[model samples]
Target: MPHKRAKRSIRDAETAKKGHNLAPQASTYDDTPRSASRIFNAHAVQSAFRKAGRITSEDTGERKPKPSSSTNTSSSSSSSKLKPQNGSSSSTTPTTKQTDPKKPAIPSILPNESLGEYNRRVEEFLRPGVSKAIKEAASIKAAEEAAFRREKKDRKKRTRIERLVKLGKMPQAALDELDKEMKNKAGKRKRGDEDEGSGSDDNDDDGDKTTTKPREREEKSFKPIEAPRRLNDIVQAPPSLPHLRKLGQEKKVGKGVYGAVGKGSGKDPLNAGQRRILEEERERVVKMYRDMKAAREEAKVEEKGAKVKVKV
Candidate 1:
């Protein structure tokens, strides 16, 4: 609705008012307007073209210094400094030195490197330490396995000693000695014996010999285990009760006087149910005797196997 110049003046007034509230300018601030240069230079477009390699012509979109007779000597000296000593026409750009062709290409971190390059170098440096740590862990695992085996063997030995002591075959002193040895070695046995006991064994031989004499006496003093007495082979005869025998005999006859009321002054005769219960009880006693006999046979076999003949 407003005229162009009136609108422009109004906008300018508003901007000037807003500018007063702005933060302080940066140190790189430039007062000159860039409107003309932005259109004519077109730096963004030139950079894009350069990156795409589309700027094929000699025109680099940059202004080159003009050659003048007054600066000829300075330009010649600068150009001379840029040239190689070999006097080749090629530009003296730096090239990385070639390495051995046969060697594998190893990634390395150079000055100002980042990302994959830095990571590669760090990994290479840590490789040996990582491998060594893995090997050490494996060795520790092996040591643990060996220690577990030794502990299992020691447990079996302890159990055997305990059994012998319970059976009166071994004295309590041997068990106490084993316990003492276990306590002494508890802390130092994890990494396995390192030949420290070899010298101690030689030095303590006399003491060991003296101790062995008492152990031998204890072994000799132990009484032999006497075999348990065999059960009495005499079979006792059944009771001579007339009423029970009569009832049992009557049971053999089918439809006999089993459930009928008895006509006697003495205790009433056992009924069919009572006779049946008595028969079951008798059978149970016979089964128990058979089981006992089998158990005795098994014990005899075990005792034969357990007998050890000392070659004196």
Candidate 2:
């Protein structure tokens, strides 16, 4: 609606007289009879048409200015543009911040950048610091883990030493000496095991030298193992076929035989159900006999009335 008041056209016009370049300035103000109305100027139209025709015919937008008359006119017009006295918004050109043209260490975000582009920029800028922090954290965690493992190993060694001391297998002073042994490069190295081994060898040599009597020679008691003479004689003899024994041969009965165990008529025929009934009847008969014995015991106790006569 606001732009409706403004009208621009390059339709009909004749450049009969000396013409100038047409450049219309847009006006913005509170609405008024003159400000809201559209105006048509014949001279302005003619100027715009001549300018367009000149541009198309010349074919080059970057036209070189004629020096003599236009030089002074352009200088005066450009210099006449007043700088903003206060905070005026009437200037056509936007103010640009002054910055160095050389690229910076970290690339800056663009005005119309997409999300993925922004993420990439952030990663490029912060990559060094983030990676360094992660490496430092990992190193610290590894150091802590290594220290924990070392502490556990030391605790196990101490427990073994303590147990040996309590059991009297190792002396208390030995345990103390072991604990006090220098572990660092600046101190003495331990050779206690080598010393103990040498000492035990020396004691064994001394015992051997101080023996009461020379080790007695015992009579030989071992007998050599020998195969039977008959086995040797038989092996040395010529090979011959072994005699067959009738009793050792397996017997094969005809059809309907009870495997190799019987002729299939040695035992009585019985089914699974009949065997189960017989077992049940056996259990019932045993229970009945036990009941009768208990009743006889009760009757004898009643008749005797807790008194029994012992014959002299």
Query: Clashing residue pairs in candidate 1, if any?
Result: none
**Residues 1-312 of candidate 1: C-alpha lDDT, one tens digit per residue:** 445355778879989988867787677866557987677678887898889976432554332233435567779566533222343333233233336775434445566877787788768866887899999899889989987898898899999999999999999999999988887777666334545557567667777566554444543567889999879857689758655454445443333465343443333677789999999999999999999999999999877777743322
| Model 1 lowest lDDT segment of ten | 82-91
lDDT by residue (127-216, candidate 2, tens digit) is: 888898999899879968976786678678878989999998988987776566525311332255467668999888898788667799
Q: Top model by lDDT, which number? A: 1
| TM-score, cand. 1 | 0.26
The per-model lDDT (C-alpha) reads 0.70, 0.64
lDDT of 2: 0.64
lDDT accuracy of residue 99 in candidate 1: 62
Model 1 regions lying over 4 Å from their true place: 1-117, 187-312
